[model samples]
Structures are given as C-alpha cells and as structure tokens.
Target chain A: LAKTTQPISMDSYEGQEVNITCSHNNIATNDYITWYQQFPSQGPRFIIQGYKTKVTNEVASLFIPADRKSSTLSLPRVSLSDTAVYYCLVGVPFSSGSARQLTFGSGTQLTVLP
Target chain B: DAGVTQSPTHLIKTRGQQVTLRCSPKSGHDTVSWYQQALGQGPQFIFQYYEEEERQRGNFPDRFSGHQFPNYSSELNVNALLLGDSALYLCASSGGTSGSSEQYFGPGTRLTVT
Candidate 1:
C-alpha cells in the first residue's frame, strides 16, 4: 500500500486558484490517485482521479506526472463554499481480495477567505 | 439518482454496549467499505465487504465487523464500544473489483460512545 503526504492547511482568497500537491513515492503500478473533498459532518466526495497526465471534471482537475510519484489537485476560482479538507488517496487493491480500500491522510484543509 | 445513504444519522452508546450502523450503497455499486473518522483527523479504513463475503480488512480490531448484503447494502457492528469509538463512521461504495474506480461516500453516521 502507498502512503500519501500533503500540507496540513492552506488559506486562499476567493477567486484564486488553489493547487494542492500530494506525494506518494511508493505508489504501486496498478494504483490510482484520487482526490476527495469533505465538509464538516459529511462524507468525503469524489473530486477527480488520474493515472497519468491529467484528468479534469466539472469540479476539479487531477494531474499525475509520468513518474506517478506525486499528483496535484487544482481548483479554479475557489469560493467560500469550497472550504474543506481535501484528501489525496492512493487506491489499493488486495492481492487476493474482492474489496479495495483507500487510505486517507490528514489531508490539506483549505480555507477560502473572503 | 440517489447517492450512498447511511442510517441513524447519530448514535449514542455506553462503553460496554454494542451498536450497529447501516449503509445503502449507490445504485449499481457492488463493493462496500467502512471507515472511521475521528475529529480533526482523516478517515481510517475498518473493513470491506463484497459479494456477501469479507474480502479485505484493515488493522481494526476483532470487535469491529461488517456484512454486505446481496443488494449491496452493508452493516457495521462494533462490540464493547469505548469512548474512543466516538467519531463519524463512513461508508464508501465503488463499482467493479478491478483497479481505477472512484468511490462514493455516504453522509456518515455519528457515533458518540459514552
């Protein structure tokens, strides 16, 4: 399994782009990098995922370099509503199991200021 | 379509008691994973169920167990709960057993052990 490390916290002003990077130096070949956002008392929501290069959704963009040792999640023009903890996870699959688990780090808490 | 849903939005139990929480996965998903999230920390994996069997489990104790129904709904049971068990329990659902799948999480059930 691969462990991820991210910043503890960040502050961003409204209408500014926020790019959070996560490091996973030991990610497996078949593992995928996923990003999730969570607000207080709610479950983490999927933001974007990528294997290599870049993948973008309506909400966020995920960038994974060829090395796959790290990834970045980009949120354009973040607003107050975007204030939440962003988790970077390396999805792991058991060798002989049907279920897979994602390990969530402490995550980078992004606070969007006024 | 309705997303993942969890029951008993909040629960309170004593140290020597037991508790059960329910989760309904998103439609078309077959795998259910359980996680425990403490205050100000990331969610920790408990276990995962697929095809009505325990596929893989995390480092959680034997006191924590789970079951997945044919309909893809799941139940998490904890025995001899302690105050440390007080936290947000999350359920995540993903489609297929292979790699490269994104998970959807439920709103979570808050369990407060006294």
Candidate 2:
C-alpha cells in the first residue's frame, strides 16, 4: 500500500477552479491514483481515477505526471456543494489479495466560499 | 439501479457490548469493503469480501470480523467494543475482483458508543 499526503484544508470561492494535489512518492508500478469526495454524514464518492497522464469526468479531472509520484484533482466551477473533504488513494485494484484494501489519508478539506 | 445500501442509519451501543452493521452491494457488484471513519479524519480500511470470502484485511484487530453472504451482502461484526469504536462505518461495493473498478459507498452507519 502506498501512503498519500495532501493539504489539510483549503479555501476557494464559488465558480472558481479548485485543484488539490496529493503526493505519493512510493507509488507502485501497478498502482492507480484515485480521488474521492466525501460529504458530512455521507460516504465517500468516487470522483476520478488515473494511471498516468490524465483522466477527466463530469465531476472532476485527475492529472498524473509520468513519474506517478504525485497527482492533482481539479474540480471546475466549484459550488457550495463542492465544499467537502477530498481523499487521494494509490493502490492496485484487487488483482492480488493484499492489494484490495483502499487506504485513505487525512484528506484535503476544500471549503468553497460564497 | 440501486447503489450500496446500509441498514440502521444510526446505532447506539455500550462499551463491552457487540454490534453488527449490514450492507447490500450495488446491483451488479460482487465485492464489498468496510471502513471506519473517525470525526475530522479520513476513513480507515477494515476488510474486503469477495465470493463470500475475506480477500483482504487492514490493520484492524480480530474483534472486527465480517461476513459476506451468497447474495453479495456483507455484515460487519465488532465485539468488546471500546469507546474508540464510535465512528461512522462505511460500506463500499465494486464490480469485480480485478482492474481499477470504481467503488460506490453508502450513506454510512453512525455508531455511537457510550
């Protein structure tokens, strides 16, 4: 399992683009960088995932460099609803028995101000 | 289709007692994973179940056991609960046993221990 470190908290204004960067220096060869959004009292929701380069979806975009040591999650046009904690995870998807668990770090708390 | 569903949205238990949390996976998902999230912190992986067997586990103790039924539903059982066990229990479901399958999480069960 790879350990990830991210900002503890961030503040952004509504309608702005928010980028949260996560560092995983020990990422494995088969590991994938995944980002999740979590609201209070609710479970974490998958935002985007990327192995290398970049991946985009309706909700967010994930950019990974060639080194795969770090990745950034970009949320466009942030709203008050986008104020939540974001988690960055690096892991292999259950290909092996030991790689099945999803390890979450302290996560980055993004507060979208009005 | 219905996403992951957890029962007893909230539970209250006393120390030294036992409690169980249930979860039904997504429509076509075959794997279920459990996690514990403390207040103001990120989630901690407990274990994952696939094909009605425990495929992987985290640093949780033996007291934190789980069972996956034939229908792909799961139950998390904790015995001799301590005050620290009070947190939100999350259940996530994914499609298969390989690849980077995205996981869907439930609303989570808030367990309060006194």
Candidate 3:
C-alpha cells in the first residue's frame, strides 16, 4: 500500500489561494494521485486527480512534479465552504490491481478565515 | 439520477451490540466500497464489493463484514461493536473495473458506540 504524508492543519484567509502538499514516496508505477475534500458529517467529495504534470479543473488544480513523489492541491479564491479536511490518495486504474481499496492517511485540515 | 445514498444518517449503539449500515449506489455504478472515518483522522478503507462479491478488503478485522445485492446496494455489518468503533461509516459507489475509477461517495452514517 502507498503511504501518504501531509500537513495536519493549515490556516488560510478567505480570498487567498491555498496550496496543500502531500508526499507519497512509495507510490506504485500505475498509481494516480487523487484528492478529496470532506466536511464534517459528509462523505468525501472528489477534488482533482493527476498522474504527472498539471491538471486544471473548475474546482482546483493538481500539480505533480516529475519525480511523482509529491503533489500539491491548489484552490484558488477559496471561500468559507473550502474549509474542510483534504485527503490525498493513490490508486491504480479502475479494476486493476488494488484499484478501489484506497488507504487514506490523516489528511490536512484547512480552516479558511474571514 | 440520484447519487450514492446511505441510510440511517446517525446511529447510537452500545458495546457488544451489532449494527448494520446500508447504501445504494449511484445510477450505472456496480461497485460499492466501505470506509470508516474516526474523528480527527482520515477515512480508512474497509472493503469493496463488486458483482455481489468481496473483491478487496482492508486491514480491518473479520468482525467487519459486508454484502452487496444484485441491485448494486450494499450493507456493512459489524458484530460485537466496541467503543473504538465510534466513527463515521462511509459508503462509496463506482462504475467498477470496466468503467472509470472515479468513485462517488454518500453522505455517510455517523455511528456512535458508547
């Protein structure tokens, strides 16, 4: 299983861009890095995913360096709704070896203030 | 179409009791996965069911079991619940190995074991 490490907590202001980094040194060769945001009593919602380089979506951008050892989730112009726990997960393509069995480490709790 | 749905939004059980949580997968999804989320920690994968069979399981004990129905609905059953079992139980649905790997999660059922 691939292990991930991330900051336990982060503080950001409302209108500022927040970049949260996660490190997964033992990631598999076919693994893709995925991020999820979870509010208090709700299931995690998908944010962004990328294998390498940068993938931009309407919600966030995923930046994975060439090394593939680390990735960053950048949320632009964050609002109070962005305050939640962010989880970084690594997995193979659907139905491949260990595809849906994701191991989530303690994610980074980001608190956006006014 | 409806997204993934979980029943019993909140449950309170005593030690040594048993509890069952249910989930209904999103439309066109055939895979169901279970997770346990403790307070202040990330969600932990418990198991995945595809085609009404246990395809993959996490490091949890045998006390944690699940079943998937032909309609793509799933159930998580826990026997002899302990105080440590107090956490949010999450259910996720996906298109299985044949389709995209993007999994959609439900609102989750909060389980409090006292």
Off by over 4 Å in 1: A92-97, B96-100
In the range B13-75, model 1's lDDT, one tens digit per residue, is 989899999999888778889999999999999998888888888998999998888798999
> What TM-scores do the predictions have?
0.94, 0.95, 0.95
Quote the lDDT for B59 in model 2.
88
Per-residue lDDT for A1-114 in model 3, tens only?
688999999999999999999999998899999999989889999888899999999999999999999999999999999999999998775652233676788899999999
Complex DockQ per candidate: 0.56, 0.61, 0.62
Candidate 2 CAPRI-style tier: medium
Interface RMSD per candidate (angstroms): 3.1, 2.4, 2.2
In candidate 2 the C-alpha lDDT for residue A20 amounts to 95
**Candidate 3: Cα lDDT at A72:** 98
How would you encode candidate 3's per-residue C-alpha lDDT over B1-114 as one tens digit per residue? 899999999999999999999999888888899999998888888999988899988889999999989898999999999999999999988874337677889999999999
> Considering lDDT, which of the candidate structures 1 and 2 is the better prediction for this target?
2
So what's the TM-score on candidate 3?
Answer: 0.95
Pairs with steric clashes in candidate 3 = none
For model 1, what share of native contacts is present? 0.62
Q: Write the per-residue lDDT of candidate 2 for residues A1-114, one digit (tens) a residue.
A: 799999999999999999999999999999999899999999999888889998998888889999999999999999999999999999975432333788899999999999
Better by DockQ, candidate 2 or 1: 2
The lDDT for every candidate, in the order shown, is: 0.89, 0.91, 0.90
